[model samples]
Target: MVSRQAGLLLAALVALAGVSVVGGEVVDAPPTLTVENDGDTTYRVTAYTVESVEDALLTNFRVTTPAGENRLVTYSQLVWPAGYRNVTVTDSVPSQQVTVPPNEAVETEIRVWEPGDVTIYIIEEPDDETHVWSDMKACTERQQEHSIRLRDGYEGGGSTCASDLDLLFR
Candidate 1:
């Protein structure tokens, strides 16, 4: 029932108060980890390092490709169309420690020639290590928070740290 002049005055007052009353979709930030393809050849899980990201946060990323060739990739930025196998940590890797200054990661790689499975494990028990863990937290989709702790060993579903990181990403 407001007149045009009154509505304009109200909008001006709202703008002066720095309030936005517009109805619009609220976008969420993308996760640090996502499944992506490397060039035209392979897929990779890239951990995006942003300013809000705390350094030395344990993200025990593991990829166990039983059949195809796999590796720790740093440079590929292409977002592979949402199709991935969700590989795990397996086999053995003869990898040189390559640091991508932007990604801030240390990784392992392995390839299996024979048909049998290759079991690979990475970054174990952050608590047992000399590295200091920050008070990073994990939160569920419901927005409940939990403490981030690395287990003595990776108990299968995912590495403890990776699982917690997944939680935080939600």
Candidate 2:
């Protein structure tokens, strides 16, 4: 039979080993970007902002590659709010466009080696007739306040109605 003192010593050693093992590795929190649709209609997300550590502003929708380098590639797609779709964006990588349904939310996991900021842009579709709720400025203001709404149409003569949501990474 094992003595009480021996058992206690073994337990303490195991605990110390566990701590040392964990201390030897560097762990970082996973970065995530989420967009929630609290409006009544669905909106298509066309672009998002990626601010690099060097303060370079980049857009995920349209990226121009450097000379002699591969074209900046961006994958855009649609996603349902409550589904098992696995969407991940690596560090310095652009995520695919995701259409967020009404009353639902979509998120992308961003893996960055350095700290930066991410801004999501929601472009409102143009309508034949002007709409009260389709104002891009209003929509942007609402988004900044964390209140998401449907962007059916814009009153102005612009081709697209775009809004942005900024997020920071440490």
Best by TM-score: 2
lDDT string, candidate 1, 85-104, tens digits: 33222223322111222223
Error of 2 at 122 (Å): 5.1
For residues 1-170, what per-residue lDDT tens digits would candidate 2 score against the true structure?
Answer: 56988978855754543322245442322234355666666655433334532222222222222233223322332111211122223335443455667777776543322223443333432221111221111122111222234433211222211222122110
- For model 1 the local lDDT of residue 8 reads 86
lDDT of 2 at 129: 13
User: Could you tally the backbone clashes for each prediction?
Assistant: 6, 6
Each model's lDDT: 0.25, 0.35
